[model samples]
Target chain A: MLLGVNHKTAPVEIRERLAFSNDPGVPYRELKAIPGCEEFTFLSTCNRVEVLFVSSKGDETERKVRDFLFAGSMSYDEAGKYVYLYKGEEAIQHLFRVGASLDSMVVGEPQILGQLKDAYRTSSDQSCTGVILNRLLHKAFSVAKRVRTETAIGSSAVSISYAAVELAKKIFGNLKGKRAMLAGAGEMAELAAQHLLNQGIAEVVVANRTFERAVNLARCFNGKPLAFEELVPELAHVDILISSTGAPDLILHKEDVKPIMKKRRNRPLFLIDIAVPRDLDSKLNDLDNVYLYGIDDLNNVIDINKSERDKEAVRAERIVTEEVLKFMLWLGSMEVTPTIVALREQAQEICRDEISRTLANCKDLSPKDQKSIEKMASAISNKLMHHPILFLKGEDAPEDQRRKLAIFRKMFSLDSVSRQDNGESD
Target chain B: MGDLLFKGTFLLYLLSTIIYSVFFFSQNKTVRKTARMFLLGAGIFHTIYLIFRYFEAGHTPLTSNHDIVSFFSWAMAWGFLSFRWRYQIKNFGSFVSILITLQLIVAAMSSSEVRELQPELQNILFPIHASIIITAIAFLAMAFCGAIMYLLQERELKSKRFGFFFSRLPSLDALDTLNHHCLSIGFPLLTLGMITGLIWSKQVFGSFWSWDPKETYSLITWLLYAAILHQRFTVGWRGRRIAFFTIIGFVVSLITFWVPSYHFTGL
Candidate 1:
């Protein structure tokens, strides 16, 4: 059983109250007493609060889990309006979709996969998840990987920082040995700086009007701090320049950049001015090898990327359906696999018993003749079992197949033997 | 056999032109690679055709307009391919292959019939002068293509709407650098070709500086390239300004090849 409140159904205000604590001990203890809940795990993220559990009571599990989540905060009837419940195959499909990021607000975003893995790890550490969930979550991870490779969902940039990295790629072609200069320590600039660093930029230069602030920002990024007056000379050494100074007058003008183009020997320079009043003059855009994008330009590119991702999301949804079907088929075969294994073991046991009886009665006969007779008996047993095994595994319609399996199990008394196999420890 | 090979080269270039245009408009990497392969095939056939024509003509096959045009087309294809390999600018071929196809078609249309050699054109230096000038034009052709791409990419960047042109064209720096590199390569070649022609004229016409129309136009083309290079190095004139002049220089060189020949009885 799976009970959850996602962005689609719940307001963030309520979600924040019911959201699970990062420490699993609180939620594990809280959910432990839910009647008939044999095992369980809690998944809480900014966009969702989901409780997945193994329960015998089916529909009642949803009520118990929801009541526990909103225990003293709200009444059952009030919280019920925000929660969605699923059971059996529906619950499995929901988990798969969430793990694959198909259910994310920004569909195909990669963060959800990591979050799901973190939840799985926490549940495993708490020993709250048993065999069924262990297999399901591992399978979900593989399905997510397949979705990532088989679709173009994660290839395009859909955020401001990602768009900045993409634009840098468009200008520099590669970022392996490039340098980035950050003119100010605005929040957006810091985010873009981190992205550039992740892309393998060799060094970073931080420049600001306030010397101590620049030094602080530089220390945070582990970059070199440049005096504000050294901005012109520093421009020659960097391939990417992001200016977000909050100055009324332009921090960068055409004349300041024009000479840098020559000193840089025509190497490309990508300028991103993300300041509110615009840190760089518009005229600086006309410089020969300098590519400049103001705040609106980056936002426009991000918008385009978002629309492109929305288109690819449709294709990603189809992949999810195909993967879910594959998982379901494998699950169906799981029940049959154990039954077939037990039946084969029972038949081989009967053949061995009869062969030993014949050998004891024929003790006066030659030893070689006794061995040949034993081999013959084993061959006959295998040939006799092959037909029944093939019939059991054949692709008949689901309803007819279930009826056939029941009759076959009863006629052969395989159910009693399977029950004994299960009771071995008992 | 010569005519058949020439036609084959012409048709192959036309096919590659279509392929490159498709690659440019669609911006698909697979189509770009396929177009590059088709171009390589065409270039191979073109080389074979040139060798065959050289054997048939008995001379160097650089004197007549038909041979000059064919040689020019081959040089453009070779130069573009080399640049594409070195720089990995696959989409730039869309504009350049079209230019190559047009040049080949003009070559196919011109008379390939071997005319009796004019007495003044029979010197060994005639082939040298023609070969250098044609090769110089090939380099200038690359510069010309780079200029057009620079303008288009600049327009897209300044407008702040990145569309097909923005995605397909190489960066502004790449195009500008290509223009500068081509000019550096072509200027020296042009100067050497003029020097060879000066020596040839002194031997045949008894005057190194003849006021012939061909001589005057070659001088004008040279001066234009020299000015472009000088401004680029000293005054830091680049990007759109340099691209515009490189394009103009290529057109004037074309005239120096075709128009001046009509003015002279034979040179």
Candidate 2:
């Protein structure tokens, strides 16, 4: 079963209230104390908090998990409005989708897969997952890999800072030796600068009205701090400039940039003006070798990329669906009763076939003789199957039982026959 | 033998161009490697063809229309290869191979008949002057290709609509640097070629400053490049404006070489 609140189902306020801490032990101890919670994994990221659990008392354990999630924050009735609960096949499908990143806020981002892997690792370290979850999570990982390789889900940029980095690559070809300057030290600017640094931009320079704030932001990036008044002079040296200052009017103008272009010998410059009222003049884009993108322009590019990503998402979702069916079949086969039934059915079919063939070969045999032969064949087949059935029915830990059932099915090739039967029934 | 070698060289260049075009779109590393090998083979075959033509013609092979154009293509092939040895510009070989193949096609279409050297053109200065000028034009041709690529890429960046050429082309900075490198070498060779030609003109024609059509056009092209180089050094004129000027200089130089006139014999 899966119970969770994601970006789509819960607003930030509710998600923040229900978010779990980074310490794996806290959730492990608290959730393990529930009356019927058999196994569970807690996953908490900025956008969602989910608990995937196995339980025998389904509704009762689900109630406790929900109450535990909302404890000290809200009543169970109020919290129910923000959470979604899935059971059985729906829960399996939901976990597959999450692992494949289809359920992410940005559907095709690659981080969710890593986050899911980290959560699974922590859960297994705490001895929180059993055989079912171990197999399910492994299946989810392979499904994610299939979606990644078969679809173009994670190729395009869907975020603002990513868009900026893409544009920088187009202009500079390589960002290894390039420098970026943040004019205002705003959140958006800082994010863009961070992305630039990640792309291997050699240095970052931060300048703000408050020199102290500039120093702090510079320390975070290990970049130089400059006074706000020196942003224009600094522009001559840097390849990219991101400005999100609170200034009401434009800080840099076309006239101001023309001289800088001469000073820099006309190296390409990429300017990002993310400020609301606009810090850089619109005419800066008119200068030779200068590329200026405002917030709206970057958003427009991101919108285009988002649509492209959405087109790829449709194909990824199909892969997830196909994988979910395969996983569900595997999950169904994990039951010992089905394996035993299928094994016995196969032995009886083979015994009946041999007895009929033997009866046909001995044309002169009496009806009583033929019946005896059939009874003897049935007794021999039962004797041959008795030890295997006993092994399958032996009392063992659930994990060991699942392992034995898997091995027994493989030994007899029972799953293939069952699959053929399924195909015929369909 | 020379004709067969020339044909083989032409075929090699065509094959190289085809492979390079494939690599441009596919961006596969092994495909690029194969394309470079084909290009290297073509360059070597062209060199052999040039040597064979010199032996068969009983003089320097750059005297005829076909020989001059073929030599121009050969120079371009080597110039591009030499650049590849030093630095890599993205998808640069694709464009340059096209240019070299197109020049070879033009050379093949013209008459390959070898003619006796003219009385005035039989001096040592003839081979020296013609080879230098053709070599300089090869580098400028590379600049022309770089300029066109720059314009295509800059338009994509400016319009904010990234189409086919956006990722396939090199960065604006790289393209601009290409133009600078080509010009830095090409401009000085051009100056040297002109000085050698002037000294030869005085020796062969009795006057150095006569305004023949080729001379006038070469002067015009030279002045244009000089101005561009001057502006680039002093006032930092680059990118779009320099690309435009480099393109114009190459066209004018081509006209100077191709337009038939009476003053330059056998050209």
Candidate 3:
């Protein structure tokens, strides 16, 4: 049973209360106690909260999770219309689509993909993802990659880092000679710097714990390398501050940046905190001209980009579907291959058996003659396999033979196993 | 040995064009594959033609507009091959085949009036100008495809006409990125070509600033392309609007390329 409310269903107020991440195993532990719940996963985001579980009693399991999430806060009836439910293959397809990021709030948003994988991994660690869900998740990832490579779906991610630079460009007209400072030189910080430099940012300052590594990284981007202690001093001069550091402690305390903020005399400062534990102080957002953006705040820009991406997505989808269908048809034809092999082996066994029997009766036959008969029998098998092998391979197949091969898959249990996967997984 | 193969290849482009048209209508994967293989084969044969023609002429292939166009189309197909391996864009082979075939037709028509290489103009810098310019145009062709796709995708969006292809196409982000990438790579190349062309003219003609039809048009085309690139990256213009400007730029290039040639007046 897959049950939840997202931006598609519930309002933001309900979604926020019900939103529960399972990284700490809190929701997973609580969910396992529900009656008839054999396996479960908790999917939580700013816009949606979903509970995917395996249960014969799908309705009861969904209700229990729904109630557990809300915890006697609001009436179930008020939330009922917003929440959705899916069971069996539909549930499988939903989860796969979600994993593929196709059903994401922002179509082709990549965060949900990593998040979904983490959720699946967490649930699997807790022994919640059964065969069905495991297969579904894996297939979803493959489809996501297919959508990425095959179709130009995610060809350009249009990430928040990109949008941040775009916003800066709108403010400054051009990035040439613009001063940019990176608080932490992590992936997001690097990406933001790269985006800035691509627009011709004149001077970029990298501030990190190890100044040597920072210097090395700065050289790659042709930027300045500054010590971590130099951050506040350098912050007053820089135009953009993107904080993405791995330190557990708060690197930029509110007071620490407040002095620099005042020293700049109301100069516009864009602070984007993409780090997981958030390097910048959130209170700094209240300050004037200090445009601070967290992961959630990026949704607005991401949504705009998504809408734009959604427009050109039409042709990409056509190309993807055509490729997907082509790939599926080719993949589906793989079932009869084993049968084709088996049949050839069966024919060869019969020939070998008969040849040995004949050899036993002719005791006067030399070893060389016996070996010749064996070779002849094997040759017969090889010759007979030639056509079927080619047919199975889509090689010069007569129209009817191709049709027969398709039929052969049906005759065997080819799709029964794969159809359960709904063509999402490998 | 190479002559028969080259002639067969020139004929093969005619057939390849028809095959590509069939694939466009049918959308048959097999037909598409056939068109791709055939185009690749034709490109190989055309390459042989150019190489042998270079030997036969006892000079480089960029002797006239005819050689430049043919050689440009060849390099363009090679560019497509490089992109096709990574991008795998559907129906591109069809589009590329039509483009290359049109170029081939124009080149073949002009092939009858081949001129011997002028001694003063036979420096390596001239070929550098020709090579960079042709390769830059190939990148422009890529941008052209991206623009076409952008318009089609935008029209589909405005119309809300979601169909089988509605989901398969590259997103606006992809198209815009592709367009920008082409401009970024092509712009420098175009600049280098222009600079080399100027140097070559100074060496051969003893003046860099003569407003020859080719020179004037090339500069005009370059400026237009430059404007589009500037607007896209700096002005944040994208999607349908950028598509219009990109095509406009390419048209300016084509006119500057084909219209002023002696083919129109001499014929």
Query: Which candidate has the top score in DockQ?
Result: 2
lDDT of 1 by residue, A1-426 (tens): 789898789865677687665565788877877776766778887678898887767667677788888877999888889998888778888988898888875556677898889888987887777655776788778778877887777777756777888778766667888999999776578768866786788888899889887886786568999999999889999999988888888888899988888887666678999998888988877777678898889898888778777777777777667666755654453455766886778778988899888878878888899888878887887898889889888997543455567667667776664345323211
User: On residues A1-426, what C-alpha lDDT tens digit does candidate 3 reach at each position?
Assistant: 788777777654556567554346788888989887776787876556788876666677778887877777788887677778887556665665676566764455566777787888888898876644565567657766766665545544466766666556433445677788886665556667766775678888888789886886676567888999888888889988888888886677678777776677545566778888878888876654455677666655566567656654665455445534544454444445665765665677689789978988999988998889889888977897687567666643333344466566565444564466455545
Model 3 misplaced stretches (Cα beyond 4 Å): A1-426, B1-3, B14-31, B163-168, B259-267
Instruction: Arrange candidates, best TM-score first.
Output: 2, 1, 3
Output the chain A TM-score of model 3.
0.48
Ranking by DockQ: 2, 1, 3
Q: Write the per-residue lDDT of candidate 1 for residues B110-204, one digit (tens) a residue.
A: 88988777777789998898888888889999899989998888787777888877667876667877888788888898899899989998998
The DockQ of each candidate is 0.17, 0.64, 0.02
The lowest-lDDT stretch of 10 consecutive residues in candidate 2 chain B is: B258-267
Tens digits of per-residue lDDT for model 2, B178-222: 999999999999999999999999999888878888888899999
lDDT at A233 for candidate 3? 82
Model 1 misplaced regions, further than 4 Å: A1-144, A209-213, A265-267, A313-426, B28-34, B84-87, B230-238, B259-263
Which consecutive 10 residues in model 2 chain A have the weakest lDDT in total? A417-426
**Which ten contiguous residues of candidate 3 chain A have the minimum total lDDT?**
A395-404
Residue A152 in candidate 1, Cα distance off native in Å? 1.8
